[model samples]
Target: NKLRVGLLFGGRSGEHEVSISSARAIAQAISSDQNAQKYELLPFYIQKDGYWLAGEIAQQVLTSGTPLQLNGSNIQLPNPSQTSLPIPTSPYLPVSSSSSSAQVADVDVWFPIIHGPNGEDGTVQGLLQLMQIPYVGSGVLGSAMGMDKIAMKMAFAQAGLPQVKYMTINRAQVWSNPCVFPKLCDQIEATLGYPCFVKPANLGSSVGIAKVRSRSELETALDNAASYDRRLIIEAGVVARELECAVLGNDNPKASVVGEITFESDFYDYETKYTAGKAGFLIPAPVPESVSSAIQEMSLQAFASVDAAGLARVDFFYVEATGEVLINEINTLPGFTATSMYPQMWEKSGVPFTELVDQLIQLALERHS
Candidate 1:
């Protein structure tokens, strides 16, 4: 029997379009896979309105350039036990909602292709946990903590790992102590000095991030980042090269060959990341054998620190002059758009796209059972 795989995509996050792109890649990859005959891919799209719908209507909306017209309704997990919980009833005659007629999706497992908030931040994972469904990727604490830069750094620190110096700013603090942010930025200027990276504490794909070379640009850059997330993070700028490693599996995870990203900007930004004909990537980064080994070792340590499952792409900042390696960030769900680094690294290591997905599915099944 074909295993029913629900490939969930789109979300109420800044990465909605990015999620769509990921979904499209999965659609094309899985549908064309000859070995996946017994394991089907059912795309479940979560519209901007938080509606979950499958079938042709969802596909049309995904491909069409037209504005999203959600002709869809909400999707809630079905309780096979059909157990009822106590709820506030009318003072006089009690009325109950008809949940027995509720529609349910037949999914052996859920593959969340959505990124950033709402989905990747552990919100959806929590719901899935309550509903007792097996889904792909890390669990609640890992997802939530990994998604937030502040929390992730805390975990790294707890694990006795090396982390770049960073400071966090929340909206309330910024508003309450109007000078709080500027003062902290000034402190960063004094401590970490100029050319630090500013980003939303909970964003990926380098969205709403800036590299400030001077204190003058600090205020504007922070304000821009604070708009995207309630909390903003500023990391001590390391004048180094950006390298990444791909990790797979849960218990005995494996790391792939080291790769390098060369961006056209001061750092990897939104356009340099996803825009067509944008950034350039090099497989098996032209680095020495010893440095590559160290990076792979550190990548596994970081992945273990977060208790990450399924797969993640760990990024690091390497100072060539100093031979110092600093952990930049670890993405639990790095891009899987075929061209993305995670799959690319694994591909170059002899795991093609279709086989990569197959292995992930096997990992999912292995974890579930």
Candidate 2:
């Protein structure tokens, strides 16, 4: 029998649309003739408002571009003894009245493509662990750490990985105590200086990130970032090349070829990352062999720093003038969309899309076993 794969996407995060695109790309790759014989695809889409969807209706919801209504039946993963498998239920699909027949088909593995917050921040991973199910990407600790910039930076510091100087802010304090704003600005200017980047601690796709060059912009940026997450991080800006590498596997993970991202926009924001033709990429970035090797090594270190598993895309800032490379961040569950860099870097390293997906699934099963 083919390995049953649960493709979970369309999460409750701001990256919901990006997750849909990722699921679409993944589904296309898995459904190809060569891969189709080896696996069965089951899609579980979590509507923006938290409703679960699957089967024919899920496909309709994805294709029709209609607002997902909560009226439909939601999916649930009951205790293992309650059902023979962890498959989600859908009102669109039929179920027999018998207890044995009420069970949905079992899935051998789960591929979570949810990009941010509730999905990638360990909440879903915790659920999967409770259900005793094997899933792709980082486990609870790694997922939680990787999702929070403050925690990730702290881990990187503990691991002795070089990184840009930064500081964190509590949204509640900043918003509630009006007097704290001036002190916060003074602290930021004294530490990171001008041209600092402000971001939500637990978001990706460049959401709620702003590059502020002045005290006024700093306040606005902080407020915007706080709107997305309870914690906010401020980092000193640097003039450097934006580089990324894809790390794969558990225990002994390896890094793929390094890639560079150069964009026409001021910085790699949400629109620049997801929108077509907004950014440009350089595969096997035209850097010295030593720089490339160093990045690949650091990529693995960053992955291990957070104890991440399955796969991650490690980003770095290469200061060409100083020849200094600083680890920026690690995306535990990077994008798998057609234009995403994770798969593209692996492709440049000679791993095709199908093979890359196959390897990730294998790693998930191996980690569970």
User: Which candidate has the top score in TM-score?
Assistant: 2
Alpha-carbon local distance difference test for all models: 0.76, 0.83
The whole-model C-alpha lDDT of candidate 1 against the native structure comes to 0.76
Give the alpha carbon lDDT tens digit for every residue of 307-344 in model 1.
88888899988899988888888888788786889989
| Candidate 1 least-lDDT 10 residues | 89-98
Name the top lDDT candidate.
2
Q: Which pairs of residues collide in model 2? A: none
Count of backbone clashes for each model?
1, 0
What is candidate 2's CA lDDT for residue 133?
A: 76
Q: Write the per-residue lDDT of candidate 2 for residues 203-256, one digit (tens) a residue.
A: 888988999999899999988888888999999999899999999999998899
Window of ten residues with lowest summed lDDT in model 2: 89-98
